[model samples]
Target: MAIAARALGPSPYGPPEGGLRNAADLIVRDAVAYAGRCDPRVSVSGEVVTGGISAVLIGESRRAFAVVLGDRGLGGFTGLLVGSVAVQVTAHARCPVLIARGTARENGPVVVGVDGSPHSDRAVAFAAEEAVLRKTDLRAVHAWTGPASTRAGDMLPLVYDPELVGEDESRLLSEATAGLTERHPDLLVAHRVVRGRAARTLIGQSHGAQLVVVGARGRGGFTGLLLGSVSQALLHHAECPVAVVRAAEV
Candidate 1:
């Protein structure tokens, strides 16, 4: 089933009640028509909810498997308004949140973030399933820094070698995706280890991707922080759709 919703709020200027209703009706009509024609077997519903957009959408997402949102702005500034809503929902919703960027390529690979965290494990599992559903290749990316850089900026940068760090990161990435490809025998998987800021690297890699999947919280994310910086960055800047996957319910 597909649900198309418009969260309404009081507007001081512009349309009156009747005009607003007409506009809402037109929006829903177009949405339903497009949705219906997309897949005949899929059932679609249109709704207009009165409240803050974020809260209304988050509430509706509780019973949904995933909440899909569109990137509001154009190419360079994609998700200007939608980023806030996407982050809010992804941080608090009980289910996964999918932020679809306007610049996404429908036929590209699915990129997934990996850092060996439990949250990332869930992300990988979800990405694997998504790759199967989309019938695309899955690219697992792990970003890591050298020990010297890993330390706070206050500390002097040590001239350390990345040989050891790279080896360990490779091992961790392999361990994280060990059984995933086996589980989905027909799925093709690729792994990469990059050294840099996690968010920037992921955003750059997302340029040609159809979708980017990341954990709601990662290794560096504190428990109190609602969402990790990497995931938050992807919501705002990824070229393709981004999926924020939370840890599985116990």
Candidate 2:
């Protein structure tokens, strides 16, 4: 489905005869045409509505499998990689929100961040389905940092065994993706546990990835925060499309 939202306001000359509607129609028409070219067998529909674009899209997202949006919209500054509308919709959308950015490799694997959080679990599930649909492999990544690494200038150096930390993180990755192969018998799956920040690690992985999927909010996020740092970072800087999936109850 193609949707275009136009906000109409009072004008001294009154509404310009069919101007908003015509522009909206053209936008949706072009979108439908492009979709038709992408897959001739798929049925396409269009809708032109009058309201705030983000609100309209968010409302429609309730029934959508996913809400796909460009990283930046028409109103943003040229230098802004992610627009306000994209961020708002991504945060509030009921289903997965896929933000299209740099050109996605047609054959790259679907990469997902796995942190053993419920939100991360949902993201893994979403990525698994996407990988199966694309007939590509799924790569689940879990990134971690030493306890003291995140802190600035400490009085005492915190000591921990790197080997044990690595082992624990590897186990976490395994547990996070334990049943993926059983659920998707034909889907290929790979696991990676790296010692680094989640966002940076996932961004590096995205370089050759067709899609990067991450939970809207990770384990470290505040309850009131709709979008987490890792998800936001990918949305702004990933090399391909980024899909942010939110847990059903969260």
Candidate 3:
């Protein structure tokens, strides 16, 4: 994890960056001892946001979870840039991003977004493992726009289109749910399929959720809309924590 901080002024508000190195080292050391995990590496790198500490973990195993710690209390001047660094990193990073507030609780349930992306498949694999390790129930949520589509003022099966779109959405949710079940049979899994905008749907669902996971980038680039817009939105404003997963091996 890349944790970077600088001593802008002094103590009380944002503690000096001096102790962060030792603190991060201690945490990693203890993790290796108790968790028996071995990334055998850690870092405290610099970023745009001054004073606040940001952690970036690199070279961790495919199954290893990366915790991006964002310290609370940003100076008014840097508040605007707070999300800038976190957002860019969250959007681009290959691993799951954990934005930890000073008040974050440990050993919490992990919430990941599944929108049928290949990236989502990878996320499911990762989150399921974490849940098993933490001994927590895994909530795999699928958000569908029953009525929201490209055309704003149009309906299919015009004769009696009693939410034909809704039926399709239900199928989408069912497929996503069933797909995960087949892939992760041993996982203690529970799923939710809700109707709303994708981002809004998941963000709202994540209120009581400990961690929110989504794809880093989706298939919505050019020819094929592969990624979910909702996934992008969740990274912007998730109540608890957010993790962006990439479907492909990057």
Candidate 4:
């Protein structure tokens, strides 16, 4: 395990000089000691840097299993939970980024967002592994918006049918989660097809979840884009820790 902290500025309002460094060292020692109490094989290290928090986190993510951030922090920045810094790091982190929400619980399902893209598929796999690790259930959620599109007055003449679209969305959700039960026979899985905006649906699910998993980029996003709107929204608004899984390269 690696514990890192960034010293942003020199002012008292900012981190005191060497404060982050000392915090980093303490975190490393405490983490190692805690892990040792749990199991003697765990080793940990410390890394403290003087730079922008988002930049340091992004850099650390290249080699870390996951980069975890608090839902809110003491930076005096207004956007704490769903803020710009969280958005930036979650969008661009190379590895999976986990935004810690509530207390890390030992129970409750691992919730994942699915959109029939390869990106979401990766999220499913990650969520599966997480479910196995947590010894919990996995809940796959998919959201569609026939009603919202109609409200937006963007409905096409023959192509826009609410019932058919909803069915298709359900089918896509099933297809995306297919074979997971067979692969992980011990893992229990459930799925829901919701009618609303994707972000709102996922955020609602987060209330009952221990962790919410999503793809860094989803089907609705451009290929070159670093993060989808839904992922960005979850990073800020989720009531539970949100995992943004990067898509595998072709």
> Per-prediction TM-score, please?
0.82, 0.89, 0.59, 0.79
Instruction: State candidate 3's TM-score.
Output: 0.59
Off by over 4 Å in 4: 1-42, 103-105, 147-159
lDDT per residue as tens, model 2, 1-250: 9886545443447755446566678899999999999999999998888778899999999999999999877788988779999999999999999998986899999999998889999999999999999999999998988642322344533788888878878888898898988999999999998889889999999998999999998877467999989999999999999999999986
Error of 3 at 250 (Å): 6.7
Overall local distance difference test of candidate 4? 0.81
Per-residue CA lDDT of model 1 for 38-135, tens digit only, reads: 89899999986667778998898878999987756233254264556666778887788888774667778899999888889999999999999999
Candidate 1 Cα misplacement greater than 4 A, ranges: 1-19, 73-83, 148-160
Q: Which stretches of candidate 3 lie over 4 Å from their true place?
A: 1-67, 71-81, 101-109, 146-164, 177-186, 221-229
Best by TM-score: 2
Query: Can you rank all candidates by TM-score, best first?
Result: 2, 1, 4, 3
- lDDT tens per residue, model 4, 95-149: 8988877644569899999987788999999999999989999999999876323
Q: Mind giving the per-residue lDDT tens digits that candidate 3 earns over 175-207?
A: 555655566566667767666666787777677
lDDT of 4 at 199: 97
Candidates' C-alpha lDDT = 0.82, 0.88, 0.57, 0.81
For candidate 2, the lDDT comes to: 0.88
The local lDDT score (0 to 100) that residue 219 gets in candidate 3 is 35
Best of the two (1, 3) by TM-score: 1
Of the candidates shown, which would achieve the greatest lDDT relative to the real structure?
2
Model 2 ranges with Cα > 4 A deviation: 1-18, 147-157
